[model samples]
Target: MHTDLWNTCLHLYARPGVERACLNLQSQGLDVCLLLCAAWLEQRGVRCDDARLKQLSDCAEPWQREVVQPLRHLRTQWREASAHDEALGALRGQIKALELEAERTVLRRLESLTQSWPSDQSQGDCDWLQRMASLAGQPDCGALQTLRAAINRA
Candidate 1:
């Protein structure tokens, strides 16, 4: 599942424009979080859908409600609005706002989930070092060595 999520994140982050890449990553990451949450709810014999989304986010303030519930609505508008339409400007603004909020909410959900079962993360510090080490011919061994020293101290 983590590998699948990493791949999805990578693909989304590798898109053309910076704004588009950020938005895509935000959307894809939120989708993964939503799937995970829905799975957890389903296993407990709970039905998860738009109704559940509203109920879960009901106590949230107006901005939060706008972020969680109107995402689909904004996406639909963004997709349907013609490129030549002047109304596209407003839709784009709303989409960007919702994207930012969704990213924040998904990050919070990920933090909570990680706190709950952090041991389930099988990846280790070495994985990061190995990936970084493979990136260049003359890598910054100093940084890597410092990291290793810190780990040893821990």
Candidate 2:
């Protein structure tokens, strides 16, 4: 729920190449939830590296690596790849698929985060859910609506 975590998740999930992002997050000892969140963040074009790590709400990286330097090598290749529309589209599709997975993961985690809250924080509950919804990219309002219905039932 930390902004850094939220922002990181938003970017990680949205990044163009999710498997690498996921692998990096995993190597950092982040839980699947956080991995899902990072994947979400990357999907949104927010890069997470040592420079940005300190800003994360969850700023604990168990396995530190100076590997961003090498990983960035993909940028040139990606630029060259732009010439091939079919390959680019396929890669984008893969990114979309990873984002969808992270979205579903976020949705599943919502209930637990909600239930574990103290009643005194009721005023902020909806706002938190909205943020989660936004991070999930639920523009069709489907996931938000489902979450609302689920909470109502409880």
In model 1, state the lDDT of residue 99.
66
lDDT per residue as tens, model 2, 8-93: 44443454544444444334433334334333343333433443333332222221122222223343355556557878757755
Listed per candidate, the RMSD to the true structure in angstroms reads: 14.6, 13.2
Q: Which candidate leads in lDDT?
A: 1
**TM-score of every candidate:** 0.35, 0.27
Model 2 quality (TM-score): 0.27
